[model samples]
Target: MDLAIVILNWNGKSWLEKFLPNVIEHSDESVIYVIDNASTDDSISFIETNFPNVSIVQNKTNFGFAGGYNEGLKNIQHEFYCLLNSDVEVTENWITPVAILFKHDSNIAAIQPKILDYNKKTHFEFAGAGGGLIDNLGFPYCRGRVFENIEKDNGQYNDETEIFWASGCCFFVRSKDFWTQNGFDARFFAHQEEIDLCWRLKNSNKKIFYTGKSTVYHVGGGTLNKQSPQKTFLNIRNNFSMILKNSPISTLLWLLPFRLVLDAFAGIYFGYQNGISHFWAVIRAHFSFYKQIPETIKLRQKSQISKFYQEKWLVFKNFL
Candidate 1:
C-alpha cells in the first residue's frame, strides 16, 4: 500500500462510530487500522464488529499517544503513515495531495493537512491551524492559531508551505523518518511529543510541511478537555523536555531560563483568571520539568546538532 492510516484510540468508541466512516469513505485507497490503548470501554469490540475490514492492535496497557503509537506502528509496514486522531472527520480526497507531496520530496519528512474545527467548520482548529511553527523561545504556534486565538478560514492560508512541526491531531510522516527518530519519545507520554519528534527530524536536516489541499475537521480534545489540569501539566512539562532534547547547547543555555520565566508569568495569569487547580498545574509542570532536566540534557547531548531554532525570541514578535 502507498500509505496506512493509524488511529490511536483510548476508549473513544463514540468518536470512532461518528468519524471512522468519513475516514474509510475518504481514504478508500489506503489501509486503515485502529490501535486500541487497552480501553475499559467497548471500543475494541465495536471496531471489530462494525469495521471488520479495519485491522486492530490491542495494547496491554494505556500508553497515551506517544507510547501507544510507537507500539502500534511496529506492526504497520508502509512507505507513509498517517497518525490520525479518532476525533477527526476527513474530507473527500484528503490523502491525495499529501501522498503526492511525499512522493516528490524525500527531504520532507512530515506533513499536516489543513485542519478545521468540526464544530465550527468555518474556523481553523486549535490543534493545528494552517500549519505549526515554533518561535525561538520553543513555543509552537500556527498560521491560523496563536495560543487560544484561532483565525477564521477565508482561504488566506491556502498555499502549501514548509512548517516547523505538524499537529498530532492528523499528522503524516514517512515511516522511515519516524523509525529513524526512534518514533515518538515514550517518555513524553502525551502532549507535544509530535513537536519533539519534528524537532529531532529538523535537527537531522529534515523538513516538515502543511498542504491546504487535504483538509480534515478536528473535534479538538476528544481525550482530554483543553482546560484539563492534566493536559496542562503534560503540555508544559513535555515542551521543556522537547527543547532540551533538540536545541543546540548555546541556545539551551539562555533559552531554557527565559522559557521558565515566561512559564512563571503564564502561571500568574492562570492563577488570576482560572483557579488554583490550573495554577498548580503550571507549578507541577515546572517542577516535573526540573526533575527531568538531567535526563533531558543527556538526550540533548546524544542528539546534539549544530543548529536548531529558526526564529529567535518569537514571543516578542508573535505575542508582545
Candidate 2:
C-alpha cells in the first residue's frame, strides 16, 4: 500500500472498539496497523478477534508515544504514514486531501487535518484546532486555539496553509522525510515531540501544512488526562528541549530566559487554579530540562532559520 495508517495503542481497548470501526469504514484502500505498546489490557486480543484484516505490531515494552511509534514504524514500508491516535473519529475522504497535498509538493514533509472536539463537534479540538503555530518565545498554539480559549468552528480556517507544526493526534508525513529525521526523538517520551520533528524539518527547508478539506474529531487525552500534572510536566519539559534544539543561538539567548520568567508566573497561576501539584510539576519540568540540556544541545542541526515564530507575545495577548 502507498499509505499506512498506524495507531499506537497502550491499554486503550475501549477507544479501539469505539473508533476503529469508524476509521475502517471511512479510510479506503489504506493499510491499517495497530502498534501495541506492550498494552496489558485485552486491546491486542480484541483487535485480533474483531478486526482480522488489520495488522498488529507488538513492542516488548511501553516506549511512550515518541519511542512507541519509532519502534513500531521501523518495519512498515510505505510512501506515506499517518500517525493516528486511537481516540480520533475520522471523516470520509480524510486521507485524499493530505495525499494530494503531499504529491503536489515534495517539500511538504508533514500535514494536519482540521481537528474538532469529539464531545463538542462545533468547536475545534485542543490538541490541534486549526493547525499548530508557535510564538516568538517558543510557546505552541493553534489558529483556532490560544491557551485554553478554543474557538468555535465557523469555517474561519478553511484554507490549506503552511504551519509551524502538525499535531501528532492525526499527523501525515512523507515516509522518506520521517526516516530522514530518524522519526521522532524518543527521549521526548510524548508531548511536543511532533513540534520538535516539524521544526527540524523546517530547518532543513521542508514544509509543514494544514488542510481544512479533511476533518477528524479527537477525543483528547485518551492515554494521558489533560489535567494530570504528569501531562503538564511533559508539555513543559519537552517544549523547552524543543526550543533549545531548533532555535538559532541568537534567538535562543533571549527567548529561553524570557520563557523561563513567563513559566514561573504560569506555575503560580496553575497552582492557584488547578492545585499545588501543577506548580511543582512546572518546577520539576525545569529541573528535567536542565538535566537534558547537554544532550539537547548536541542534537542541534547545523542550520536553523532565524524567523520561525508566527506571532509575538501570544501567551500574554491570549491570557492577559
Candidate 3:
C-alpha cells in the first residue's frame, strides 16, 4: 500500500535538514510530506533547496502538533499514513512489520513502533514512553514511566501487545480509518491527542497496539520544548478535553472527581511557585473544555457510529 509519511515542523529547519536524509535511508515505500507551520527560520527555502524530492506544505501560521499533522494528513491521498516527528529516526523499514501487524489484526486501528531516545541512553522519551498507557482517570502515563520508573533503554522491553494508546511520535495508521475517525481533534492543538483518538477507537471496538520488532529513536518535543509552560498548559487542557469528548460515560463518571481533586491541588501548588502563569494555565485548561463544547458535541455525535459500550469498553479500558 502507498503510505504518506507526514512530518510537521515549526522553525525546525535544522532538524528537518538532518532528519529527512536518515528517514529516507530507513524507509522508501512512502512519500515524505512536510507541513511547515510558518517559520521565520527559512525552513521553506531550505527544504526547497536541500530536499527537492520531498513535498512541503508551507502553512502561513503555526498550528501546533495536532493542527499541523491534521493539515498534512488532509493533503495525503495514500492507502495508509505514517505520522512522524521530524526529529525522530527510524531504525529500519518500520512499515513492513507494522503492515504485518495490521494484516493480522483487523481490529487494530493504530500501531506505534517501540520508541526510544538515545541522546540519553538511559531515559525513555517521555512522549511515547514505551507504548502509551492510561490510568482510570484518563490520565496517560507509560510502561516506562508512571509516577516515574522511566528505565534506561537497555533492551529490556520486547513484548508487544494491544495497548491503551499508540504514541503519536511515529505512528502508522490506515488512511481511511484516520479520516473516518475525523483525524486529530483540532481542539487539542498539541498534547494527548493520540490518546484521545485511540480512546475513541477503543470505544468503537478497535484495538491500539505497540509492536516490538519495529524501532525508532525520538528526539522528543521537537516543536515545543518540554519545559515550556505552553506545553504544560496544552497537556493539562487536552487531558480535560479528551475526558470531555471520548471517554465512555461510565469512564468519565469514574474519573472526574479523582482528576479534579488532583489537578486542583497541582494548580495551587504550581501557582505558588511559578506565580500566576502556572495557576492560570490549568484554570484555563478547565475552562477550555467549556470553550470547546460546540465542537465537542459534534465529535461525540460523529464518534457514536460504532460505539462499543459496557463490557467491551470496560474490558479495553481495564487493559491499563
> Number of clashes in every candidate structure?
0, 0, 0
For candidate 1, lDDT tens digit of each residue in 27-137? 977999999999999998998899899999988899999999999999898988999999999998888889888878889999999999999999999998899999989
Runs off by more than 4 Å, candidate 2: 305-320
For residues 207-247, write the lDDT of model 3, one tens digit per residue: 98888778888887677776666776888878877886776
Q: State, as a TM-score between 0 and 1, how close model 2 is to the true structure.
A: 0.94
Residue ranges of candidate 1 with Cα displaced over 4 Å: 301-320
lDDT values, one for every candidate: 0.90, 0.93, 0.79
- Writing each residue's lDDT as its tens digit, candidate 2 over 166-248 gives 99999999999999999899999999999999999998999999999999999998889999999999999999999899988
TM-scores of all predicted structures: 0.93, 0.94, 0.89
Candidate 2 shows a clash count of 0
